[model samples]
Target: MKSKTVLITGGSSGIGKAIGIYLTTKGYNVYGTTRNIAKYPNFNDFKLVQMDVRNAQSIKDCIDEVLTNEVRLDVVINNAGVGITGPLEETPSEEIVNAFDTNFSGPLNVIKAVLPIMRKQQKGLIINITSIAGYMGLPYRGIYSATKGALEIITESLRMETKSFGINITCLAPGDFATNIASGRYHAPVIKNSPYEKVYGDTLKAIDKDVDNGGNPIQVAKKVHGIIEAKNPKIHYKVGTFFQKFSIILKRVLPDNWYEKLLMNYSSK
Candidate 1:
């Protein structure tokens, strides 16, 4: 069997890095992108590229580099993203815009850059790393959820559009996972004399606590491997602990008022 080549964004750490390491062991030629490549110690059998997803030129250059070096691309995983956590009112406009650029626009740029190559090959896979927040709304995570929500729609459209070309698009919607993403969250600057200061402050604290108890990133990576290698991949894969599954199911079955009350109560304490 011929080896498959995969290009992964944000491959230096977290789920992306875990997937990259696993795929390499599975005999895949993996090329991953990272802004700071030197941070990751030399890992065996994985190639690293310096690319920023927020920059269109960087994304195009990264894809071009992959084409020039590998000659063929079998898979493209859009996993590079950032988290901005705060209530909509408290979150600054600039913060929201940056979040959208990194989470939504960045993926679009990467996908656009890679599609031409994938179209020519007529056979390829695109896996997008979304969050459960994409499906269920969280109290203080409006901006983050909006970005994931956009990704969900884009994935659906791409799936339908590329059906004739034999290209598969799958969105991996993992619940909270223990990753640097939580600690690395960018908070909107707090106003010194704002009425919502206490509320926003409390929300941030709750978010941090939830993230601390999230599931392991390695588990999510294993699920990603399965998704990529599966003969017929599902459009959405929800991988998380029992609570995550329960919450998503609840959101679907429960009434709006009941769900809102439950979420508010849960987050309040």
Candidate 2:
């Protein structure tokens, strides 16, 4: 049984919870973070700690507590993030800031807190949760795409900067999954006369439908465990419906106009 400690953010539900529970069964010591532990009164599968990724101090404190006891932190999963929707022009400025803070900067905060400990240990892994949308901006979820894309770039850069110290970092660009994310997703208020109102509403509904009927979160957790066990992991990995995963290939090979039209049609479905 592997005894290394793994810390995962946003573990109260969805992929985070799935990964936490799955890894606990695999014999790895698991610690999961959530802003409110009260919601999980019966959460006994693994340890759950209070953490808010948007707050740097909260992140630091959580990692400190884990390292204070665990002594060696093995894996860090940056999965705690939020989603925001609407056309770029109409999305509230504060919402955009909050989205980026949670999605992009949030990972950096966790990584910053754990890097020193991992580097000292001379071995660690950081698995960033990006998205298929990170590969390309979706119509109404542009900010969400941008935030995840930023994390992907950050992960790539971090891999090059940390490998010499034996720290590995990679991103998981999942297509869509059945999760509680939609319940918490924020939508920008479209004005009664906004030009984007029609397409935005249609696209939002389609995206939500796609997510509501998407892949099981356990599939993602299993891949995360495999990546953690592997001797060498890729810079980026994809998990989700076959079509969403294939979109990456299409984005690379298809003509610009064709791909744009395809994306538009799909988003507007």
Candidate 3:
């Protein structure tokens, strides 16, 4: 296969960074974007640029920079996102908006910016890094699920619409990995005397523990490379452990009440 140019957002750390490095090793020219370059600077072996997916101008600027030298963008990984945990009632409006803006609209901005180029070139791949939470609503992480589920629907539509143009769009829904996502997660007011304190504390601790024991970030990167090389990749890729991916099927097959109970039990444990 010919060499390709790849652009990955939020590539400074975690899965994005891992994908960039893995792709570079395979001979693809890679440009990884991050808002904070100083902290990451360079991650092993990918070129770094400053780009915030939530900002249209920043997205345009980064794509323009990549196009300048690379001539064409062969792949785009929409990996920039944020995590928020709070009861829907207590989660601030601003926090909700920010979650949607960063996790959902951010990918839309990048996709819109790059679509023209890819359509003209007649071939490209767009991967939106979503999460398994998107498949179902988890209590405190409802907003996060909404954002990812929204992206999945959008990506499905895009795949159908862009089929003839050779633009391949896929959603990479990962379960959990030991990334810094937990450290920087958004929090709603879980102050003393709040009714949700005990539950919130318990759920958050459980979530973090699951992530700590989750698969390595590099595993996702390897799957990304497979998606890149496949002539006909699927519309969605699940990068997680056996049971986590299986839960998607379980959700569809199980009775509604049963599934809800499962989520209640699983998330709170």
lDDT values, one for every candidate? 0.85, 0.90, 0.90
Give residue 92's lDDT in candidate 2 (0 to 100): 86
Q: Lowest summed lDDT over 10 consecutive residues: which window, candidate 1?
A: 36-45
Tell me how far the alpha carbon of residue 68 in candidate 2 is from the true structure, in angstroms, after superposition.
2.9
Can you tell me which runs of candidate 3 are displaced by over 4 Å?
42-44
TM-scores for the candidates? 0.93, 0.97, 0.96
* Model 2 lDDT tens row, 123-167: 999999999899997788899999999999989899999999999
Q: How do the residues 87-162 of candidate 1 rate in per-residue lDDT, one tens digit apiece? A: 6887789988989999999988888888888889998999999998888678778889899989998899989998
Give the clash count for each candidate. Answer: 0, 0, 0
| Each model's Cα RMSD | 1.8, 1.2, 1.3
lDDT of 3: 0.90
* Model 2 clashing residue pairs (backbone): none
Output the worst ten-in-a-row residue range by lDDT, candidate 2: 189-198
Model 1 deviation from native, Cα RMSD in Å: 1.8
Clashes of 3: 0
